[model samples]
Target chain A: MSGIVLPRRQLIARAGGLVAAAGALPLLSGCDAINEAPAVRKILSMGEEMHRASQRALTDRDALAREFTRADLSPVFRPNGTRLPEGEAYAAHAARGFADWRVAVTGLVARPLSLSMADIRAMPQRSQITRHDCVEGWSAIGEWTGVQLSRVLAAAGLKDSARYIVFRCADRIGDADYYESCDLVDALHPQTILAWALNRQLLPIANGAPLRLRIERQLGYKHAKYLSAIEAVASLDGIGAGKGGYWEDRVDYEWYAGI
Target chain B: MTDLPPAMPPVRVYRHRLPTRLWHWLNALTLLVLLMSGLMIFNAHPRLYWGQYGANHDRAWLEIGSTRDAGYLRVGSWKVDTTGVLGRWTDGEGATQRWAFPSWATIPTRYSLADGRRWHLSFAWLLAIALTLYMLWTAFGGHLAKDLHVRRGEWAPRHIWRDIKDHARLRFPAGEAAARYNILQKLSYIGVIFVVLPLMIFTGLAMSPGFNATAPWLIDLFGGRQSARSIHFIAAWALVAFFLVHIAMVLLAGPVNEVRSMITGWFRLPPAKGERA
Candidate 1:
């Protein structure tokens, strides 16, 4: 078309309009489509009530799930997704005990920093015992110790634009890079940690040993292991499929797998 | 010419989107196959309690065979499976049927487990992601709120009574009335989608460790591991029931119309005057 440029004010207005549109998305539904009808409306209302009840059933709003004894561990916590990473760089890191593993924190931050394992451990730490629930219909509980991700993000000095934090991992599930993203609310949750140790020892190779994630509220898949890089973004629209998960992207895993 | 109340026609609008229709039918078929396979797998162990292994007794022929490289543990003496474990010894009645092959040809339970995990896990994603995306799209387009907005007509006592009467006569929504799932389909399908599926996924995950930080509350809420198992089983059965009712309703209302709507995304309803009054 023409080489005319829109005014900067007009551009900002359009962007603001878009954000407002997304925020008010729930209102768009006619309110008579997904949840109402003439026949079973009463029963469905009951279903809605049951859903609210289910929410209340989740207790310990502040108290974290217990950290368990090593004896309470699974016989074999099978490795998920990538047994070993694809890239040569990850292979080298694997060959070594990941002793020199440096996690890069960049994107939408005033201070972009890379921290060593010791640097991470030296920072504030959180230890919790929680059960891991894999989609495979199995459950196991183990103790995890790591740096709380919130502190790291705080250290990086998040810009006003930051909305989501993306974890770029060494593991690859098919062609796309295995990554996970979470909103600021979840990233700042107390239980969410950048775990470096499992069962009182350094992380094991099979179990995302050196460094992994522990987003306690979501499903096992959300607790991405084999951590390498962390990036903060304003929106996930540019990310893979606009879905904020590895399996959620490759297959169709739900991004919100909150129990 | 336009005096007819601006065409405030009695024609009704369907609540379910085309994608939802597709998902419902596809999910039904896959879930049926999955449930069947799940039952067959369950038959292999038939362990009563949750996560607790059952002792191979004389009453049933279910055993969870553990692999032993040490060669010290020998429970039975007979021909082995392909995995080279041991013999297929019967507990009581010598019932030799196992979901897997005999020891000589039988691989360890891990083989079956790992594969089942892959399929179940992957398919669960399809269900979840599709639902999520549809919800997102619907939310943006205001579809969810609109359909769920129950007018006073929907909740009145008379409406309920009329629904009962209609159901008793084996008469259901037809033509444009059926085109829009007369209040009943809207509510039930939403429940199946929003309530049941999420709970199923949550309870399933509550039983796993690799991918989640375990919630003790879930354990307590469901009355421990065994109780969670019971809830999960019951929820699955409820889904199955919903499936049966849904199919029977489709058969009654018109399967060809129902199936075509799902697959082709075009719903054909009989004329309004021809529909049951």
Candidate 2:
């Protein structure tokens, strides 16, 4: 096996040829081709997959994101992505202090739920001060208190077919409704929360008030804010543009934004 | 004129080896991608902060921001409006766009943080592997001792001062001495290889949340991700300065000779004056 390894130059040449071939295959795939050269597509997918696999393999699956001291918290945690979700429906919910708000949990679960804000707050609470690293090159620390998503899934009793957890948000950017998803691993992680409080107070509207998904290990975008519903599915094929998230659909943001 | 002897033949000596040449070209490409993509990434949050956390509402040590009609550059309390150049600018077709660095400086030549990251991260992997191998080869092959390492004698004030003075006068050693690196070259190379590159790689890893979980100590060593980011940006600029100075020296010494030596490994050393072949 060692003797069969080609020299670096030969390996590069062979890879380049394969990349060119991959680039040419876009014609057959049409719009599903990710709007990039197949070569780039290959590299991006391979890189993301390798990153995900390596993280899973090399690190403890339950290893938590670094927690910070209260001193480390930003004076005011910045609101990222869509601040206040538009439309009268969300405004009406906000007006009544989310008295009528209900998170409809459906699909591939034995007990589908329509849990309210009061119900979520009533569940076991976990609060931790953690850093939020934005993909856009800034980081801020904030204290978040909410229910663990794993407990919610367990309450609903996940069916064997449920492989992914998708969050549908009320915020709309550019023309589409915002959405994001995660695999079972992150969805069931101990730190993953349905956070409704920040800095010892109710979550401000700008910071995904009422509720937001806090998948601590992922980038800020994956923490989908203004969350309205949770859906369990076996495959992401039918999700928005078949890529999982709003940003992932619109742009080529990786579905598995683990970092 | 008739009494003057024939000019001495310039001796050809091996300067950059194959590994060095390979590393040079690869680094050139990778660093270019890293810098351009890095600039694009920076444009997303054109602000810098100290300590562990910073956001829009928090105090930023530095920022390049734009209003609806104008651009401003801020450092702590100081603010400078730099319209049509930074914060806001016109592209090639005269369309206005907001950017800290111009579009020409970024990858894709347009605004796309996602694409910038793809280019940056992909090349990052390539650079890490290449640099690790190059460092190993340099250390094991005696290249570090033979050419890169500054000798104890060379560190003497007089010797260092002479080298600096010679450099200021655009004077390089000739003949046998020219074949080996000067003290300045040795020190700068050492700084870049040992200090800058490693810092870049470490700070980069510190930014990755995956690495943070696997090696949380790295983030702590750098005083959190935001500090690591600040250091990374500062180091990148330092590297840019090093690159500019390196190119300037190459141009001063003789671009053709210096560039050819890096490419082909056979450097033609200038003959000593008043010496016959």
Candidate 3:
């Protein structure tokens, strides 16, 4: 009992020291030099990895994103990030009703294919009412109709080495075209689609007209609107900023935004 | 002088336990991070709604926004020009920024939804796991039944009313009476631990898309995802209020002794009236 009573003082002191260390981290992180430290970055990355691994452990690999009834659809589905793509190429495609636009699926595939809008629409299509969860703390339910991306990947005969799918979009934010990528696990999800229609109508200009990748399990940013091309790659090393997505590269958004 | 009667000092009692102290401090840090990061995340939308869905065109129950001339905060039918405080304010750099919650109250101190989310989700795991472990430890370790649970005699309305009256007068129990928590303290602890914390954790998980895939019924339980978000915001504010009241009570009771008790698990119990120190 005497030993237990004496140790309390030491316990308090040790706890105080640990708390002080944790408190100092934000102060040090505020400085550019300290924030850029490999150890600090590694710790931050480790937190994200832990979260991703734990969430993955909880759910099945092919678990579906929740589907809702038509009555659950929002009165107006809000468009996030860049509303429209600018440039002559996108304008030319839009002007011709995207008739000339083709989604080029190349790199590490047995048969590289340039699929026209007509060709994509002619494929067996699926329509579902799913909630679009924005990373910015809002959600809206909308109906989407499209061909499963896995079907397209199968049609192109993805090479066994294809580990990730990179989406190169026509939308430009700053100097670079907005781009995003996902692991093959997400790519092959049953509900992941290259949606050409919303609410039984042609996709609106403000809502990724012509085509948008609706990877339902992730946040709105991962959906990658105004899609121009798809590339199958074994690694994300050489992609734009190389963190798997535009926001992930520029703003340190986690690549695996399952939540 | 050596033969004179000796003076008695205040009695020291072991009040809080070590695990409780550890849990309290950890919760303090986690809650602070969660609240600040949550506020920053809220700044992204600046609106709250009821039912299943809401957007720019749809009506919202609450909104914080700014126009060219002034800022406004609206809740239900009531609206206030909260300019220069809530909806719009100047930051450390003297640049005007529009936000629902000011820069001082948010993580990053600047607009970055991505960073805000990263902090919020990371600390959420800490809060959830810690609370779970703490609850389990308190229950199985006999702390709950021994200290937190109100006694049969104390449950009487007269006794409860007396405790309330004493608290209203800032008259905390002393000496032998102070060895255990008062009925009021136990009740508030129960409210925060079992009610508020669980609500916060559940509503938070309800808002996550990935979690929704696993448990869509949670969203339905809260009426909708937006409803869950609204409830989360409200509960966070409730927690903040609870924290403020907790700190105020600590100060009122005698800061040094109260704080030391929480920190070191040893408390100098206040003497009863006409009793020797």
Candidate 4:
């Protein structure tokens, strides 16, 4: 009886191992297939929308991200993604301290304006020390000083038809220049700024020098750096892959990255 | 003496309600997806730190990384080589992939933070909503008082000690006694339901930048965002441990009977020892 029971148990265990191995192969591929399915992807994306709507509903529109004092600042703010833009065009601007660089405000605006570095500096500047959260789950605190994006949008006179503000960058990733967008809620948020300085010094080239968007409430990717243009549009259609931002188009990152 | 009457057939009794059974399965699926996808997300930055802010330049309390020929997990001053399992492992193609967790353990079966976040965040809604409903039902629907509530005497140290000893010895109760949860079972269920699950949800929310703005008090509650993240990771493992022990207990008590109780709400009681047919 012992002999029979022991052999059967061993056989069952071996069969179980074989079954698991066979099952796992298909299971892994099945997961990938489900992930790649357009219907499944669309349903998953609804979670992002749900998060955005729920957050908006729960909090005041003007609620602020926590601000840190100077003492709480990270000693060195680590730079991520396109530390420096490529090409002789960016090198020439950087070599001359970006004096000739201009950020053009165009599209769906009452007045299109090409403002240089000096023009930006003359505008009322707002400085903030805020946490920069990366999508990879790390964070760094730094001081950013620049003109409020609301002030710039107001000066340019945003057309009533405008629904999204798209930022074009000097950095070319892959075949296209990096770009990002946000709706009026974040575009006109007082904390949103086109920062030109970091940690009480001129922003380093590694950290989007000369100009960058500081959408304090969003993740690092939403803060487009190496600014070249700011376009306000009635719709995000016809943009790169019709997504609001570069990563959103390329890797399916959530357009609204407030999470 | 006259021969004893034939032993009575084992009693088949109702052991679980519909809501309990439904939630049990739903939670099982939700937790598995959350854990797998979460591991994929962790692969993005396989390090844990404390305080309000931490990044590449800041020191990490725990990290999983690979060197030239070896994989390691470092917890503060201590380090262990986890080669061929964690930090570094071979994929199905026999290619040596260096990631914090192996491919089989992640949701996509490949490294894709974007896909991982989508899976994690999507199922996170299921976890949160189900847990809320389950808790509400448990509290107001008499499941708590009827099934899980500790009676007067069960609170005594001796009573708890006896339960622990019985569990350690695999002396699970038989007959009518087996129908109810013992003290140890009651405590663990209460802990997981009331404490651990809520902590997972809150710490998860605390990591969200948007949620941080909405409720900065959450950060303060957990000491900091990074701290919340660390606690979240630790609680995930705690849930895994609880799952393992829970499975073992089921198998020990009687897999067929236990599983049927959860699935079909019917359990066949084991006869008490020394009973004769």
Encode model 2's per-residue lDDT on A1-259: one tens digit a residue: 0000112322433454444345433332232223245676667566567667877888888888888878777887888777788999999999999888899899999999999999999999999999888888777889999999998999999999999999998888766898999999899998999999999999999899889988888888889998889999999998888989877766566676665
Worst 10 residues of 2 chain B by lDDT: B107-116
Q: Give the interface-residue alpha carbon RMSD of model 1.
A: 17.4
Q: Which stretches of candidate 4 lie over 4 Å from their true place?
A: A1-24
Candidate with maximal DockQ: 4
Q: Candidate 3 — which pairs collide? A: none
TM-score of each: 0.49, 0.89, 0.91, 0.94
lDDT of candidate 4 over A1-259, digit per residue (tens): 0000011322433454444456547778667667776799899999899989988887777888898899999988989888878999999999999999999999999999999999999999999999998888898999999999999999999999999999999998757788999999899998999999999899999899889999988888999999999999999999998998888877778887877
Predicted candidate 4 versus true structure: per-residue lDDT over B107-203, tens digit per residue: 8776778888899999999999999999999999998999999999999999999999999999999878888888999899999999999999999
Task: After the best TM-score superposition of candidate 3, give how far the Cα of residue B258 lies from its true spot, in angstroms.
Answer: 0.6
After superposing candidate 2, which stretches have Cα over 4 Å from the reference?
A: A1-38, B1-7, B67-70, B78-81
Model 1 over residues A1-259: C-alpha lDDT tens digits? Answer: 0001112322433453343345333332222122123343343233323422443354333445445566656554545545566778877877787778999999999999899888999998888776665443344567789999989998999889999999988776545667888777678879889998887788887677578888866556777778889999999887887877766554334455453
Cα RMSD (Å) per model? 17.5, 8.1, 8.8, 8.4
lDDT of each: 0.58, 0.82, 0.82, 0.88
What is the descending TM-score order?
4, 3, 2, 1
Better of 1 and 3 by TM-score: 3
Best by lDDT: 4
Chain A TM per prediction: 0.73, 0.85, 0.86, 0.90
Misplaced by over 4 Å in model 1 are A1-63, A69-71, B1-218, B221-227, B234-277
Between 3 and 4, whose lDDT is larger?
4
DockQ (CA atoms), all models: 0.04, 0.30, 0.28, 0.36
Give the alpha carbon lDDT tens digit for every residue of B23-110 in model 1.
Answer: 6677775575345434433433333234411122221122234343311112234323423222233212244433332322211111
Model 4 per-residue lDDT at A196: 96
